[model samples]
Target: MDLMARVTAVVGGVMVMLQRVGAPRTQAVGTKPVIPSARKQGIMTLKMPTAKGWASGQLPKTAPGLKVNAFASGLDHPRWIEVLPNGDVLVAEAKEQPNPPKTLMDRATQATMRRARAIGVSANRISLWRDADGDGVAERREVFLEGQNQPFGMALVNGTFYVGNTDGIVAFPYEEGETRLNGPGRKLVEFKPGGHWTRSLIVSPDQSKLYAGVGSLSNIGDQGMQAEEGRAAIWELDLASGAARIFASGLRNPVGMAWEPVTGALWTVVNERDGLGDETPPDYLTSVEEDGFYGWPYCYWGGTVDDRVAQDPQMVSRAITPDYALGGHTASLGLCWMPAGTLPGFSEGMVIGQHGSWNRSVLSGYRLIFVPFENGRPAGPPQDILWGFLSEDEKFSYGRPVGVAIGPDKASLLMADDVGNVIWRITGV
Candidate 1:
């Protein structure tokens, strides 16, 4: 390379570094901040502005016409959330486990146990938050169910509420405003538990089948592809007959699942296998086709084979497909269809919450995005809808959005912040 060209490149790199290091905290002049790195793409992440404290943590205040309110607070380890038609909300308090001993049998085993403890949080019970008076505040907050193992996914079907536990599935009879269950919850399905325990539960659009996602125990492997333990597959259950079978396999960590309204197809937000450097396996938002293999523990993002597991002969034939793929380590979660005809421009799109990741050096996600579709298919790249949950500095995050649910009013969106233990209500301006 020429000496002058090399000198210019070095100076430009130094200038970009200095600018980012000394960037002002004030809001950027234009609509969105321009990120100098090619990795930022077009979307920008902004730090949440200061606001008056309502409860314990900071509340995100919306613009003049846009109203931001906290539905409930002071909960213990709240995670995935669901809003009922009668203005009641159901929240899964993540179940916490006791920390294991520092010294283990081997280094690999100890590392696995440590990661398991770090990711796990306290939410073994379900809590119901009800606002009887239309006051934007919840007056009644009570536990709906207890003694359940690390439950995450939840669905209400024909007056029956189903909960997805770490190792099994259970169902309870649910009334519109009832806060507690009368009898013990009945077991629906049972499965082996793994390290990554973000199981998502959903039923078919016609209410005929129950769909559940089981993430892989290990990040990536090819030795035990079809083994019963680290299966990393999506399953379908017969609601009436109590029968269950694998629907799709090779998904690393399918955390969020929702049935698309327009296509009536199951769409999942999957966190693909990590540890292959900065950008190896891209987390994907894709439809769950029958008997499909998503190439986990081997291939990812449209046959982009992993260098670690590429030599596995079994993965060579598994044809993989993804509708839309987000960048690596975004930790996509909780997807829902925007209420049709309610918001002017969101009728034809789906909203997904990208629960930011901590593994990467520079954190990404911590916002909800809209993947627009036309005639029941993806239109283009995913667009940022509600962001500003994390700052560019990456030191502090106000809230980690894990769940997205269309509100009971049909005019607003409810996001569950697991870290802050609160539910944020976002309304149109």
Candidate 2:
């Protein structure tokens, strides 16, 4: 009874607080958002919308000239998507790894996550979907691989399949059209695991090395720097030698990485830390450089000292300013280079799946967006490609967008909606 009452009280309080929350700041959207003085959050803002699966005959609202349809549905928390050259789709279904609450705040946060459907036993496997015909919708679904420690990213290179398991990178022999991987995969590189667990994998354009994005173990290194060792940075693995090393540092939580075609630069969308005011430092999309620092615990937005973490003025000095702001707490987790004509009116840019915010009073990201790139840099304001995730009253979300990929068809766009358990495909109207 007590547990039920606490959950109920939290849900009820969510409705009350959301009504009084302020709107997202407009100036915080472009190449140079005014970074405001950091105001520590009191009462630790917790405002998660209740998860309500989509109703019958429902669809996400598309942009002016695009249309959206369910490429795949009835999934078990499909969080990321990848496409193979054979035109098969691999959906990485995962969620938060189990962690017992050690403090009162932890318990409260877990309860809130439950109310929001953000807490679930990770499926810990990748499922393959196929569209044998030229249709946009997938006709069959089957398990491709299983028994992983919360796998998120996947890659196929030189006839070998790689799974970015939370603890390490594993490899298995793969054929062109096999729907299932029967043999046990061998681990190539090991990670510490736990903390932020989404290990996104990408192959360098030259196809010489593999890169994986590993997030920090604590919000702001609260658990100490030792725990954060081998974390909060991107790791590069040399396939031939089976050797790995950190490629970049201080990214906080870098989820997606894509090479900007024009400049041959690696770009990523990072989820900035919370507890700061609603818009103190926005999550950003920036070109990542080798051995670069983007300021995790000690600073943010290029040298803005956090003062909360142990001061590292020298490290802060090396922190490179991010290229573009994604609105504070948007939770932009997905990124893919959309070549020109992938969508109408959008040309040569990045598509981001903002999973939305749970702690913000006024929610920031519950939609899929596109930022056009010109000469390897963000050119103008962002454009919403799909929205209407939240309810009319802002009390519920029918679905939340996450990972994104160009569909097997090559011209269409695909996105994972974890809350709704669906993968949306967008194409020209």
Please give the range of 10 consecutive residues that has the lowest summed lDDT in model 2: 18-27
Worst 10 residues of 1 by lDDT: 27-36
The TM-scores, one per candidate, come to: 0.80, 0.96
Highest lDDT model number: 2
Runs off by more than 4 Å, candidate 2: 1-24
**TM-score of model number 1:** 0.80
- Report the C-alpha lDDT of model 2 over 269-312, residue by residue, as the tens digit: 99888877777789999999999988888899998999788898
Give each model's whole-structure lDDT: 0.67, 0.88
